[model samples]
Target: MSTTAHSLDRLIDESVFAGRIYLDGEWIEGGGGEIASIEPATGETLAMVGVASAADVARAAEGAARAQREWAATPHPVRAGVLRRAGQLWEQHAEEIMGWNVREVGAIPPLAGFALHVTAAECYEASALPSAPLGQVLSSEEPRISLAEQVPVGVVGVISPFNVPLILGIRAVAPALALGNAVLLKPDPRTVITGGVSMVRIFEEAGLPAGLLQLVPGGAEVGEAMVSDPRVRVIAFTGSTRAGRAVGELAGRHLKRAHLELGGNSAFLVRADADVDQAVNLATWGAFLHQGQICMTVGRHIVHESLFDAYVEKLAAKAESMVVGDPAAGQVHLGPLIDEVQRDRVHTLVQDAVAQGAELRAGGTYEGLFYRPTVLANTPRDAAAYCDEVFGPVASVVSYSTDDEAVELASATDYGLSLGIVSKDALGALDLARRIPTGIVHINDQTVNDEANAPFGGTGSSGTGSRHGGVQANVDAFTETRWITLRREPGQYPL
Candidate 1:
């Protein structure tokens, strides 16, 4: 198959663009390393993803360091133009990108389209140079002067995950390149063919210089190398908390900068007076969108006792009607889990919860990688599924007689990424929103995640550092804040 996906009749050509690894401005094998990626839907061997050794990561980092200075010296306006052009190229290739996202990453077409939209906007903003913050040149009482400036860090190593690959990867790469920093991106092996390679082409299409962006598509060893590389000044990662801790440890040891967007068990609360219909519809997005692989997907739910049974019945019924099948079909509401491992994990969670006495009001079984859009109610607080992230289409719900209980129930989890509330009283909703311990709170809707421009990240187990709103995870990851002074006279004042 051609790199361009639409030219082929089917979504996945299976003959080309499969198992290909693009590194350091070239597509090559992992030397002695190789791994296969099978279509979870049919168990067909689609392609092989190169498994890079730690040495390959070191080479990529060296390349990034070598080209970083030149890239940092490129004029800012020209850099901005390149990014804008990249956004245009991204639009041109949306079809191929979306197809890869659907077939390889197992994202439904609608969600893939949304991911592409976010990618275009993010790349444009990341590449488009921001107005330098102006400094006030006020004449000081001590008769002093002032100055203004901005500078670039060296090389950044970006490690992204399977869910929302394009957005998360470029979320670091775009800003790093635009800010005159070179980038070495290690895209998750699952969707690197489209998420990683296509991103490189977009940058090249927009006139980015060679070596400005280097990609290393692999698994664990590469991740370790990227985070621990002495030349890689910054590391941006999105994955699990266990992995985030490992990254944090390595960063601490090496004095490297690491930005982590870890796991989340976001909660959605429905009050007694909430619009039941709206809450049920919101369930579709909050719990099952992208099959709940999102870091901020609503995995834990709290419903007022007044509406608990009614809401559970409605939500479970809606989920039961959902179509869990081929992502390319365009008629399905939900798709299969990424692979067998994730499928088994989801199944284990649901089964364990049922065994522990939680009421499984809906699906609790799996057919290969397909875990039906499932829901659970009467989840006892002690049940493992009650407060943990299932990371699948499974939703665990508990009842709360008071709003205070809702807040307590929501905050009980170690994560604090996001929380959604449904209340008839506006003030009550706002009050709960303020009290809820989460980075994002939605009052009337269940989908708490909003615009790409918004500041998004989590608290506690979720993560440290923000992903959007101009606070790049890279530069902000490891930085030293300083207070500089400009003196009018040659003599300096004492502290």
Candidate 2:
């Protein structure tokens, strides 16, 4: 093994990556050819991961289906114990996982560490799900008792994105498993090792039964196979809006349960009464965290005209001050995007906005995949940067003359995932937050925020459904409620 590989082995169990796929309690070489896992920071081939063919997906689905009944029959406490152990294991190897995230995903230490912590926290939170109230007793008429009980929906197919692979995948996987559903996880091709292999090893070490959680590493074909399979009852996905729409449509056609946590071009509105320094800090973190590749990254900043100039100047300076470089080398506030395609996409959006009369106020240069944190001012409403999901280290400042205009500009986008409001008056921010159509709204904070115990999702094109974080997080998504009633006495009838 190379030095990097050897170092990684010391962090995580080396056996986890011995083969490409983890199916039926063993590692196996995939039918599909190998894929090169490239480190975005240095543009080097990190490792070769095996890709799963459609047949591999089919077999994994079959294994999950076969194991679903026995796994579901296990006591809830037993399931919770497994999840709790998995959380402990994650905590033990967190630094290693964080390091892998930095090297593989180009995530800054803070963001990478945050993702790792959240991933483990999700497991801990999900441990309580099996013991939560899954049903209720209702008063019934005509001398009868009515009761509703929750039951597992059987096998689930999980498709996660590359941006925050561990947390995104575990957000659904941990909950689904806790609720007695088998999961066939298909991680993003670029992050197969950290996203798929590592997770599988953690669960296995936690004493989960064979075939309960399967990892199939592959491309779009594998995802399609899992979605089309009749045995797979639910699909939990996190990715772009376009891809989520396709998955949603396919699930609808198949009449399968689907939970989608999709894209977002969230807005941050700075009221005239807001503190400029505080607002600038929130804007900087919201827009440039993870190079602004996050789904909830702030794409537009709507500030009152009175404070617009000051906000723009301060935000520009803040963006300019961000450290951008290889995340594996040293400390950095901003890191590279996933690859060249994403870098070019962000650059095109910025260039187009400038061409359309938007001023490039701060940073717009790049070295390889590392695009500097960029701030734009006076961006036209029709500019791509303002109208679309940039999904990069770019934020646009648009001035609003009135409160109505602020809300209007914030709601003008086709996506309505998250909204951030900064104001001195808490009541006023809350009042405005109600009027916004996004699924999640934060007062006096940034749009890019999440917790393991709160509901996290969006509206309009952002997501097809919501996924909560507490005990009830995946109950609705992974289980079906059955209503039952028993008659104490027979009804009178003429025979």
Against the true structure, whose lDDT is highest?
2
Please give, for residues 67-86, the per-residue lDDT of candidate 1 as tens digits: 87887777678888888888
Q: What TM-score would every model get versus the actual structure?
A: 0.91, 0.96
Task: Judge candidate 2 at residue 465 and give its lDDT.
Answer: 57
RMSD in order of candidates: 3.4, 2.5
Off-target runs (Cα >4 Å) in candidate 1 are: 1-20, 134-149, 448-450, 471-495
Off by over 4 Å in 2: 1-19, 489-495
In model 2, the clashing pairs are none
lDDT measured at residue 370 in model 2 versus the true structure, 0 to 100: 91
Looking at model 1, residue 174 earns an lDDT score of 80
Report every candidate's CA lDDT.
Answer: 0.76, 0.88
